[model samples]
Target: MIQVDRLTKRYGSFKAVDGITFSVGRGEIVGLLGPNGAGKTTTMRVLTTFLGPTSGRATLAGHDVLDEPLEVRRRVGYLPENVPLYLEMRVREYLLYRAKLKDVPRSRRRAAIHEVITRCRLGDVEDRILGHLSKGFRQRVGLAEAMVHDPDILILDEPTAGLDPIQIREVRALIRELGDRHTILLSTHIMSEVEAVCGRVIIIAKGKIAVDDRLDRLRSESSIVLEARGPADAIRRGLESVPGVEHVVQAKVEGDYAAFEIHTKNGSDLREELAQRVLQNGWPLRQLDIRRTTLEDRFIQAVTRETISAEAEREAV
Candidate 1:
């Protein structure tokens, strides 16, 4: 379990994370997504006690991040973007050391290390030097070290940053399996990864929380794509005049037919009306379909909106 209320982190005058609030429930996997420099890594660092927040408060499993940092660390296993690895140490050796650092009991330390090694698929390379391993193997070593202590929560930043497709799929499956037992807050640039393993998504931009919602609900947001052959202006006006249509924007022109994306209100299905309108106007309808909103679409929309707002604020001043 994790709780962050108005969490803010700053470096000099630049605010990295600004007044963002969200929570991850027990056994839930939540994706923290954003563009570059959107404070995703900053937020994770603050939660993991690697960096302190400038203001606001965060608690991990009921332990205050600032006042009870040690307790927080005990409950959180962190795998940063660029994992801090001891290049000379063997995979199992590094995990053994990490287990000790996380205070795994002497009796269970061996068992914990073994479990993580197997779970993270590090068995074959367990005896190999970390520095000599491939990037994918090294990433697995980092994951094993993080899970070596069996912490209640896992804070992973770019867990699959440098892995091949096969390795990425393996890691994604492992994360999904881990979610059954640990509350996970993951940060990554891959939308399909979130869609695959995360039940919820929190999109951050410009140092602020932009969208936080269930993955299914967010993906359920849909719009209509219509392509018709007619005067572009007339087709646009007709679609815009539809009762539930919010607005219509011409996507592109393919010869005589033009594609228009129709954004509707309240996720309404106005496809029938739109088709009739096209027919009434004597325009040949080429395509009319509802396009489900994707995680990437929502991510881009949030970040773009934030960027525009920031620009507007700067211009006003």
Candidate 2:
């Protein structure tokens, strides 16, 4: 339901976002991940029609973001990082105002206000003045205002920033619940939050796309970490004979039992072979599973690899 093709943005002499391209289907949750100053916010603004792209094009649900921006805005809900909140208004009042501005019919404004308040967990404080609410509540209030019009798509830029662990979880649950009915574009540096809610990831770096793939597919394709428990000496000796096992390390454990990880070649599956070896040796196997690397590792690997590759290309010139 979202399409960005060769989108670029520049500020004076600096290129904030350079030729990034990707798309998100209906009901899909796509994550935009990168370090600070990686142009994630720039991309979001362009897609939201808050800012015009220097070049290229984007569309939301068949509406051109540049030529038909009003239509795009009508279908897309955006929660910026700073969450332009009006402190003087009560929670429900502020949402009602935004709902009206989004062109919600007079008949639907009250229902829209109540729906977002309930969906965003602002029920208890719906009558509370926004300025008096906690930082967590204020963030949700921002989210509520963004969704007051009940748009088909939601683009959240760091929606959980400055919130406690409890608030983070609450925000995550809300995002997942929203995704069931709306296409979501989640932008955050918090790997755990992305891990918890996002189905696919689009990593941006140096104003370019790094990786875009499903979470499970990314880990399954790269490196699968295997943790095995058995006789230290025998397991070590036997694993060395197993083809495709590149590196093996005996991990330190509390008890006498030995634990080790088998790092194998890419796209290799060594579980069955290792299992047979453990049975053949009559060793008690404690644990055997292919542990994939965390999203953090994958993110770091993707960004670092791109940086080094860019440097190598420059040096070659």
Candidate 3:
């Protein structure tokens, strides 16, 4: 479990993280989803005690990040955005070295190294030189290094960045496997990666927490996209009569058929009502559906709204 309260971080006149607060439960995987310059990495640094906050506090698994830095470090495994790796050493050698560095007691170092090597699926390159490994392999080594200490909390920053489709799936699988046993705070700019790996998402913009919610909840707030092949006029009139249906637009045109999108409350499912309405109106329904907005859509919509709101405030001055 981790808790961050009113955490603020400043550099001169600029703030990197502004009064943000959130909590992560034991074995829960939460994502920090945002664009570049959103201060996600800066906030993660503060959580891991790599950088002190300008104000407020962050405690990981109940150990104050500032008061008990060493303890927090021991309990947290951090894979920074730009993973620091020593390529000169063999894959296994580098991990063993980091295991020791993380103070994985000398007695347990051998097993710890082996545990992470296997956990991160670094078998083929275990004996190969780190410099000789592919980008995917190097990423595995970096992940292995993070797990060397057997920490309970894993904070991975863009762990799947630059990986190909197959490689990304493998890494995502590894993260999910780890999530079963560790509390996870995943930070990434890749929307698909977050959607594939994270259960909850936290959006940060302009050095502040904009929104934090379950992925499912965020999508529920997006516009509903629907498709129906029927007499356009009847379909539109019946759909318009439905309460909570704010607006409907023809999204696509395919000969005699058409695609319609209904913007409703948080993209709520309106197909059943739409079906009934179309039936009563005697308009043959071809497609009445609500497409679940993806994490990408939700992220863009939510973050853009926040940025626009903030900009408007400044412009109003």
Taking all chains together, each candidate's TM-score versus the true structure is 0.91, 0.81, 0.82
Residue 307 in candidate 1, Cα distance off native in Å = 0.6
lDDT of 2 by residue, 141-178 (tens): 98888788888899999999899999988999999999
Quick one: best lDDT, which candidate?
1
Local distance difference test, each candidate = 0.91, 0.86, 0.84
Q: Which segments of candidate 2 are over 4 A away from where they belong?
A: 222-266, 271-291, 313-317
Expressed as tens digits, the lDDT of each residue in 233-269 for candidate 1 is 9899999998999989899998999999999999999
What's the C-alpha lDDT at position 216 in model 2?
86
Clashes of each: 0, 1, 2
Point out the higher-scoring one by TM-score: 1 or 3: 1
Better of 2 and 3 by lDDT: 2
Q: What is the C-alpha local distance difference test score of candidate 3?
A: 0.84
Clashing pairs in 2: 225-291
